[model samples]
Target: MIGVLVTFAQTGKFDRSTLAKIAGELRGPFEGMAGLRFKSFMLDEEGGQARNFYAWDDEEKARSFFTAELVEKVTGIYGAPPTIEYLDIVGFVDNSGT
Candidate 1:
């Protein structure tokens, strides 16, 4: 599996409610996305960072999502370019069902 970590700095622009709203808005684009296994939306309120962890079926689709247009959009939202990291998903565990 391919794992992607997309991190953006979120300062005063997005409060908790607004962040939740943005997350909700993104759900539509993520839904029914081919090769997307799962996505985790994260917030580091203290550090002022918004993060997204995406597990994909392959590298191609993972890279495909980070297009030029997407970079521009994210930059506009965050007021800067995002820090993106792509890694191989070597291991994992799921306890959400419990």
Candidate 2:
């Protein structure tokens, strides 16, 4: 599995509602993405940040979302370029039983 962490740091003061909007807007496009096993949306009001954590069965498919154009678009909205980190998944425990 491939683990990707994408975080957007707000370049200014913000509120909880803004965080909610960020979470919704940013996550909308990647919902039900191909090769995505699972995704989690995160918001940190005090930290003024929004994040998306994804588990992918295919790294190539995950990488496809971080195109240069998309990066520019995201930066336009977030006020700063997003910090994207790709990590190896040594192990994961899922008791959800889906």
Candidate 3:
């Protein structure tokens, strides 16, 4: 399993509703993706940051989704480049029914 973490500094002009909508727009299309096990997101208002946890079968599968179009779309909304961290998950517990 692979994990992708993204942290962003919010512009502060956007409200909670807008943030939720943006997150939905970004993640909704990934629902049917193959080799992608799951995704979980966290947003911190105090820190003005966001994190996304992605579980995939391999690194190649993860890269395939970070295409030019996706990058453009994301940068257009977020304004600044996000710091992404990729990791190999050794173990986990999921009550979400994997």
Reference-based TM-score of each model: 0.86, 0.78, 0.80
lDDT score for candidate 3 against the true structure:
0.74
Report the C-alpha lDDT of model 2 over 3-87, residue by residue, as the tens digit.
Answer: 9998888777556686678767767666776788888877767787777788998778879868999889878876778899998
TM-score winner between 1 and 2, please give it: 1
Model 3 worst lDDT window (10 residues): 6-15
Q: Candidate 2, residue 81: CA error in Å?
A: 0.9
Q: Clashing residue pairs, candidate 2?
A: none
Q: Candidate 3 has which clashing residue pairs, if any?
A: none
Order the numbered candidates by TM-score, best leading.
1, 3, 2
Ranking by lDDT: 1, 2, 3
Scored by TM-score, the top model is 1
Positional deviation of residue 82's Cα in model 2 after best superposition, in angstroms:
0.4
- 2 versus 3: better TM-score goes to: 3
The CA lDDT of each predicted structure is 0.84, 0.80, 0.74
Best by lDDT: 1
lDDT of 3 by residue, 5-97 (tens): 766666764356767877788787778879988887667767777656788888898877777787676767877566677888899887876
